[model samples]
Target: MDMWLHTANGQVNLRVSRQLYTVQSEYQTIEIFESPEYGRLLVLDGDVIFSRSDEFIYNEMVVHVPMAVHPHVKKVLIIGGGDGGVARELTAYADIEEIHIVEPDQVFVEACKTYFPETAQSFDDPRVQLIHRDGLRYLRGRQGEYDLIISDSTDPFGHTAGLFTKEFYGSCYRALREDGILVYQHGSPFFDEDETAFRSMHRKVYHSFPISRVYQAHIPTCPSGYWMFGFASKQYHPVTDCNPQRWQARNIKTWYYTTNLHRGAFMLPKYVEDLLKEAEAK
Candidate 1:
């Protein structure tokens, strides 16, 4: 039931256990297999995307920070997060009117719904509208549409390769409203040294927006236990004035994100800052 998985850098390893499960309602799929280490790590057509377990940290950060910063966020668009973890966090906000989840693979969504109920429950919420199609194609057909666009995609490989392209970033810029914010999960900062993809995306997004910044988070499953998120906004920066007393009133117990943590996350290390500066100069 247990298997060892090696990291890309060959410096880290994980022992995963296999389990069995099923999802009964809506796009149901029968029992297949589950990875006990990181919850359901699925290998479909040689592409990997998490199907279950505690990887919500990445999704939560990508979804919550932009929502929290833009208090008036009424509409949200999530690209490629068929697992619904981002959608789950979006439902937590009472002000959100509609959440559009655009995922290309119906099977991935179905598998998640069946085997990983917690990650899939957000799809059941009335506020969520699931769209089965290519995310870039969908974005190309829309304009000035969303209040916030969260690109909850897999690593920049295979079908997800388009997500990091400048064309896609351009479309995302057009898809957002005037005051909209775009937050995308830019892969792990550890293994990715050149950061060419992130820099290219940042340059494209900076063309139309006044604010473009990158932040990092530590996730156990991701490479180097560190990941980065890029935020682009037409009218807002990720850092905003927060009413500490009001946030305290919400009474929510957060594992990783907080008012203090939010500010701290933006403070980048000297190395990363230097890299970004070099990229900007080029």
Candidate 2:
């Protein structure tokens, strides 16, 4: 008899089989097959936070927002996205001349390509350059190089804790061009209990860029069923006049992202907003 491990939340059910097969997401039908040493592959409705198969949602938000806001985004850098999702999205724009992806874990990239072909296909594009190295080390070596820097990292845990540090943010500030934009996955505000750490992180980012804001989206696999993204820019504000022509041209249908939804997503709940304000005050 085959054994199965299952977890359910409402109508969603995630199942892992002893056959070493696992579904990565429900909406996209992403699956991975391997041993437990590679981490558990979870199938979510739209996208999984850290898994390779769920790269679409994450890569889209990380790349598109900064790319769209900037009139000319020629050089891009992605940190911690070994799955190549952000690299894939950055290549979508004709203006993006080059994209450099720095991911520390070569094993994750290899595993993704082997088990999650759909998500790994992004790496096949010629415009992307992959580097197997620590993001902090990579950023430290460059100064004012990239037009946009996107950090698609895991939660602030273990090897990734340094990615959330003020020192890292400062390095990012130095690594970006004069008018560059920096976007990072800041985890879910709903499940974030370390108010001090959150506040400090925001403050550190604010010190580096004149414009900084946090946006939200409901990602089922993440904690509290919501995820937050931080956006900061040296010279440009994030708000933009909706370009119907561009929107129509892309023809990208999304379950969560929309023209009107862009502005609406920035509006946090009253309580959440109040907490942010309080944090800023300290």
Candidate 3:
């Protein structure tokens, strides 16, 4: 059977070679299957969160770019990354003291443990504490505790809608230390509807944080092949403040992210620059 996912231009059809598992969690439906091209595909609430083939592209960029900027990331908070990919990346560092993943759906986490063990094994790390609570509510009153906060939620829709709002970002901003960094998926800029939301979300974050930057990664399974992520900080600037030498000393090996590419990711296309410029102008 062919599984279809909506994209900016049209729809991407993944040729499903085998159906592995389907489970309904408290919040959403989780599906695991194999696609001839994508290998294992994780579908949540009718969207492809990631496919084994290209997950590294998304996970590496989201985790390493920020980690490279903040030299001493002792503690990190990942919101809605129940798939465990983000935590898996953070666990690579020996200096990182704590990694907290706040995911509301227990069943989804369990399913991931069984199917995507590559990422799920990260939950077993002693430094990582998986909290079975809503990410937004969990951040409340935890002022200035974490050095990095990763909003790894799904798209800006359904239960994930709150993750992109001003109130949610305010909670994240307050929860981070003065030098903390905030990074999250900032949808595609190719389509009309998604573009509007992307601009609005960046503006909402810009209102709260001083240094707001956007970066891009191309994941074929995502709505638009061109996907962007937000990187905001209270003190550190992503480019000028990036500590490539210090980060390299840690010896955290990654397949996709590099200090050279880290600088290039922020060098947006003129069209993308125009998009963020429009957001800032409004």
What lDDT tens digits, residue by residue, belong to model 1 across residues 12-47?
455657535433333223343455556666443322
Candidate 2 positional error at 201, Å: 1.9
Tens-place lDDT digits, model 3, residues 1-282: 565444333545567777799988779888887988889999887677899999999999999999888878999999988889999998898889999999999999999999999989899899999999988889888899999999999877788788888999999999999899999999888877677888899889988899999998889888767889999999999999988898888888788888999999999988889889989987
Q: How much is the lDDT of residue 5 in candidate 3?
A: 43
lDDT of 3: 0.88
**Which model scores highest in lDDT?**
3
Sort the predicted structures by TM-score, highest score first: 3, 1, 2
TM agreement with the true structure for every prediction = 0.86, 0.81, 0.96
Model 1 spans with C-alpha error above 4 angstroms:
7-12, 19-53, 192-194, 241-248
In terms of lDDT, model 2 sits at 0.68
Poorest 10 consecutive residues by lDDT, candidate 3:
3-12
Sorted on lDDT, best first, the list reads 3, 1, 2
Instruction: Give the clashing pairs for model 3.
Output: none
Candidate 2 weakest ten by summed lDDT: 26-35
As a whole number from 0 to 100, the lDDT of residue 99 in candidate 2 is: 83
lDDT of candidate 2 over 1-282, digit per residue (tens) = 333333332322333343434343211233343223324453322233444334455666776666556777888888877777677666667667888889876666776787666667878888888898888888886899989999887756657678999889989988999998899886665534645666677777877778888877765445566677889888877666335356546666554456666676678887667656776676
How far is each candidate from the true structure, as Cα RMSD in Å?
A: 3.9, 6.1, 1.6
